[model samples]
Target: MMTFRDKTVVFNAPKVMGILNVTPDSFSDGGQFNKLDDALKQTEKMIASGATFIDIGGESTRPGATPVTLEEELDRVIPVIDAITERFDTIVSIDTSKSEVMLEAANHGASLINDVRALSQPGALETASRLAQEHNIPTCIMHMQGTPETMQDLPRYNSVVDEVIEFFRAQIERLTANGFEYKQIMLDPGFGFGKTLDHNYEILKRFDEFTQFDLPVLAGMSRKSMIGNLLNKGITERLAGDICVNTVASLAGASILRVHDVGEAADVSKIIEKLNQINV
Candidate 1:
């Protein structure tokens, strides 16, 4: 269980985190909700459908994605976050790697930090630590071999599972050394960040291994290349595949499933939890 200010999210069941990309260039839903009204409408829809958390991202971290200026990123996400918090009562997960952006988003009512880089950016660790201490929110640490601009260039690892475990262990140590607690942190293996199709599937197959750390694990494989490349489907047509991925992750003990299709993911969670409860 993680508490954010006055909000507490208990992972008694698999939680669905709806994705709200407010950028104009995200690989999947870019330009779909760059407008405030559109973004707000989407937020309402996701909340009504049963999303426990809404992840708002400004910059596009898609492969070979162009970098946005600090001011541009702030402009894109802050207002949307403000509107969502004002109109909704769900937890808001800010998907950003910049320290300033994270700090400002927290001020705007961001309840969680979902940094893809895992708070490894220069001032990210300090900023996340301060926010966690001040707001009592949890931070998600993801494992990526390199920057988004070059991560997919030729990602490699002698043993993906072992390497990821090593990375998480080191990162957890660092976070604890710098004033963060084990209970206040989560882990994400970064399915496609710097991995091949085989690597992604391998992580999915062995995701439960991460549970040994005693921290909640998050899996975000929504409409990613891992599914698209494997099924030869476009972004929009990958919903079926995405739901399959979410189901697999949930069965493997994932605490949170970050996804674009909230309703489908909610249904998946319901069915999975029901099956788990049955004596058969």
Candidate 2:
């Protein structure tokens, strides 16, 4: 077990986290994994494709996505997690905002909480802190300016980089003050969440600056509008751009890549890792 600076264990070294969204509203693979067999197959494929972690999300957080009830969300994700964790060696991370779901999922063997809201939800940090303290699961503190429904509509940032940095700083301070383990924490500068194309690239370019906090950075620009807007392609056509974004994020010191296409991201990361080795 890797130790955080006197906090939660690091669980494992930085690795690619595959996205497994089993909802009808996900922008990329909605309705594809609503069935048990399909969900299992996708999980198996991601495992075989070199995913060290599987992030199972039930709700679609894509821009303007409608919300699902906790029961509905649980109905989609838990069984899939139950299926995958039994068959795979990968660490399971639950992507949720509800405190009840987090607690239940954590008890059901989730090792991480990949929260988009960064525990700002009511009782979120407290719930996460309890889980972390008792369960020893690492949590990710991600930055998002607004909710998905309105995030993409006329999003603005005075200085994207500074704003993100400040968000992380404040969240980390809060987590630390609450006696949560800092080492069990990671940070993400939300790429397409409320960011313009230029803002997205700037975050990607300056991603290394986030290392100043001495925690891992998770970059998740998979099939997002950032790529589509830049290349004028649809979601399916964003694979190449996604690979490129993965490469750039790796180069800029991203420790993990959250993606839809696990194999492609694995390939890109391998090549980037090789280049990094040569340079080093």
Best by lDDT: 1
lDDT of 1: 0.92
Candidate that scores best on TM-score = 1
Candidate 2 residue runs with Cα over 4 Å from true position: 1-14
Model 1 weakest lDDT span, ten residues long: 4-13
Pairs that clash in candidate 2: none
RMSD of each: 1.0, 2.6
For each candidate, how many residue pairs have backbone atoms clashing (under 3 Å)? 0, 0
